[model samples]
Target chain A: MSTAGESGKGVGGLSTAKRRPGRRPGSADTRGEIIIAARKIFSEKGFDKATIRGIAREAGVDPALVHHYFDTKDGIFVAALQLPVEPAKVVPLILAGPREEVGERLVRFVLTMTADPEAREPVIALMRSAMTNEQVVVMIREFLTAAVLNRVVEALGIPPVNMEVAFAQVFGVILMRYVLRLEPLASIEVEELVQIVAPTIQRYLGGD
Target chain B: MSTAGESGKGVGGLSTAKRRPGRRPGSADTRGEIIIAARKIFSEKGFDKATIRGIAREAGVDPALVHHYFDTKDGIFVAALQLPVEPAKVVPLILAGPREEVGERLVRFVLTMTADPEAREPVIALMRSAMTNEQVVVMIREFLTAAVLNRVVEALGIPPVNMEVAFAQVFGVILMRYVLRLEPLASIEVEELVQIVAPTIQRYLGGD
Candidate 1:
């Protein structure tokens, strides 16, 4: 009899899949398992060395099963981070506020997301990976350019010529404080930091 | 009998003792050769994978010669980059100006250093290497803290508690614009960008 747990098994005997069969059993569950495994393996070994087979083994699925969920290693990586969070979810909220207030919202969102202990590790991992892994770096660069910075440019209605430089200024501030953990910026209260930084971001995003 | 370029041949030979004919015959020349080789190898293989033997081979000197010049891989790295220009050299210049003017000077220094096409590659390589190598990262963080931001804190006469956060904000802005290559920032004129960002950095560094 295939019990809820048994249904999770694959090429490996007695799969280590964390989900019970009670959860929907299609793409979603399989995808989730791959993500959890990838995150673990990527964190342990880093991007260059972590293999697909290792992720598959950890997830308790066949190598093919892992591929079925994610078409390639990069695909698995993007899925693992739950990244490329749709701008649609964030852009409207930022735009809904007054033009001057956009910087505050943007700063708050980034700080809140990165400040969470649970969320911090994945971001740090992704950044570390992006430095070493060419494909991942390209993907991250593209996503940052297209989804996050582009939307800010659009929302602010800045000239296309100015968009790139402005976004660089805003993103640079976040990267230094959040990823590099530079002093003063890292230790400051978020509200205080935001109050000081937001206006510059707003000016960059909105225009002179 | 010894000439500068001919002595370079000794630098290219793989045997350490053979390469050293006269008193300190090839020491300075050998060190220079090693640095050139190391820069090429490091740029190609990056910091993590580039080996001492590979650098020795490229320099045409024995591995011992490479070690003689630099005690460890990091010693070679720091020497190769010639990055001993710490905050002590740069920071006081930043603080020397009026408080309101400090941000512009700080941003100008970073942007100017990075914007130069010749200097840009090494800075980028340093950033990428620091992300992957913990030792290098710690060295960089400490240097930036002690030499740059801490001085700013002292100059401003703020409590030590406040220095870290202030540094974070200022460095954050610099990193985003320079390292990440964010839009508008990467594209914008340095002077324009400096004008816009300086006040905020000034505020974070010392402004009320």
Candidate 2:
């Protein structure tokens, strides 16, 4: 995070860097910088208290530029947490295949998405925030509901509660295996986990 | 927290409250007070940093008395987290039933324990700590391993990894239901949850 952007001040140094008419789209670097700053502030202060201006300050960018790019704090959050394979895009892929295999698809998706460090950033950030802050928990719930979970339940035609239980079961496994790095669960292979966990998820999705 | 006990001094008023030879077995209330203080300190400062003296001060009791009752910081932690239904006692009971039903028993036990506000306090406290502090996570994992999980795995004669996976799945559900309060999972009935989750646990425990 850049230390130069003064805190709580109106768009001071940012006016010069402001987007010009027909100027090439702002570099993705500024957006990336803002995300890094947002990740830090959100984790430290949580969703309820993390201010966009604070994030902009940490990023050494103008608050107006932040507003221009992300439009709102929630927009910045959603962008920061945008998983490499957007859940909205992938949940359908998992659901489209054989109905009975939805559990395997869903389990595999989580295990695979989290298998790599870079791929897991958005999830880790969101999960950490959710664990610490009630507001972030609600925000994450809304995000997951909109981006992936509710859609999966709708397509499966299962009770939303069952899907939630299934999701929580898998979510818990990820928390143990990755975040907490608990033994056995942490070291188990993804395929092995899929075999063990997929059936449970399957039951929640399809079982009576 | 006792307001009478001043903070950050070398055991000020505690000298008078120091245990005496015939001090009436250190009333259970004092022990209880110490546990309450310990819980708050441990949660706020985490396992590594929370000092015995700090807990004693918060309890408004002598530090020597704290040591006399709990022996060590770890002992205090164990006492603080000891649930109403000791896992040592309950795991055997769960295992004594038909082996096939062991999963159901275990799943029901967790859901029921967490369903009650007072009973769930220790688990919730440890879970919240585990989520935030790496040291606390290790401590909680070790505690679970010693108190209940390893014993359950041994009694079942299943691969320990499978047992861990089963536990993580259920643990995850609790996190979602109570900690994160995700929809459907949060609101689902314990019986309904058992019906949905028990089979998965059964599969992990006894299935191929």
Candidate 3:
């Protein structure tokens, strides 16, 4: 997060040396920096109040570069929140298998997502933060609705509440396993978790 | 918690006026003071390290009164952590009905426990604290195993891991509905949640 733009205030941000103007589009660290900056701005102003311009200023990059990387405000927000996988990408992965296997697939997928400590940290951190921050809850609720849960609900054509419950069950498992590190759940193999959880998840999704 | 005994540094605790040797057995507020003191000591010294004598000292009471009130250290821990229902109390309730209906009863009971803002606060606070503190998580896990989950596991004859998974499902619901307030899970009717969740919970318990 560049304090330079924040201190100077409004538009003409940071040094001329730092402004790349979409030149380093392939830069990974720059993408990471933008996400870090976006996280701060979103936490401070919330989703609706935050803008591409503000996030760009905070990242010490031009607004055009933000658009070039993320394409839209929601994209930036998703990046900021650090979801385990791309929302656009995860839907197809979840839906590609047989309808009856959706629950197992989902359990497997989520367990896989959290298996990597680096990937799991932000997701766990989001849930952890949401416990204390209402603003974080609102941000998470909005993101879950717009990016992840709603699409799955639409694809499955189930009641939204039912999907939320299904999500809750799986989400709880993640909490127990990853955050709480509740034993046996934490150490239990992925295949075992899928067996124990998939049927219930399937039942919630309107399958047997 | 009484700071008087905590600072005085020995067995000679509090004033003669305050130390009633098992005298107000029915006094509700004193019991509350003891629990509050236990929470502080448990947080400070951890579960194993915390002693009934120390807790009594902190509450400015006789150690005999602590035993009279709680029967054992584990009982005192349960009271301190504030499980929504008693561990000794809740298992009978969860197991009293038809096995098929166990999930319904469990979900309904948990939801009811959290429905009251007063009762819900400590449970939610424990979870919130557990997210940040490893000591709190250890205390919670030990308490859950001894007080709640193991009894149910033995009652139903399911594997311990299976029971933990069932708990993860319900724990997740409590988190989503109460802590995170993830709607419509947060706003949905209790009966509806029971309907959505019972079957999954039932499955985890080796029912149906």
TM-score winner between 2 and 3, please give it: 3
lDDT of 3: 0.76
TM-score of chain B of each: 0.58, 0.66, 0.76
Q: Can you rank all candidates by TM-score, best first?
A: 3, 2, 1
Per-residue error (Å), model 1, residue B27: 4.8
lDDT of 3 by residue, B1-208 (tens): 2223233233333334353554343244667778998988888877667888999888877787777667777788877877556678778877997888888888888877778888888888888999899888877777777668889988888888888888888878887787667668889888878888887788878544
Q: Model 1 chain A: which ten-residue window has the lowest total lDDT?
A: A1-10
Query: Compared with the true structure, what per-residue lDDT tens digits does model 1 show for residues A50-72?
Result: 77889888877667666655656
* Candidate lDDT values, in order: 0.62, 0.73, 0.76
Better of 1 and 3 by TM-score: 3
- C-alpha lDDT of candidate 2 relative to the true structure: 0.73
Per-model TM against the reference: 0.60, 0.70, 0.81
Error of 3 at A83 (Å): 3.5
RMSD of model 3 against the true structure: 7.2
Chain B only: TM-score of model 2: 0.66
Model 3 Cα lDDT, one tens digit per residue, A1-208 = 1222232233332334353554344354666678888998888877767899999888887888787677777778866676656676677788887898898898888887788897888888887889899889877777777677889888888888877888888888888888767677889888878888888888888543
**Model 2 TM-score, 2 decimals:** 0.70
User: Which residue segments of model 2 deviate by more than 4 Å?
Assistant: A1-77, B1-77, B82-84
Cα RMSD of all models vs. native, in order, equals 10.5, 9.2, 7.2
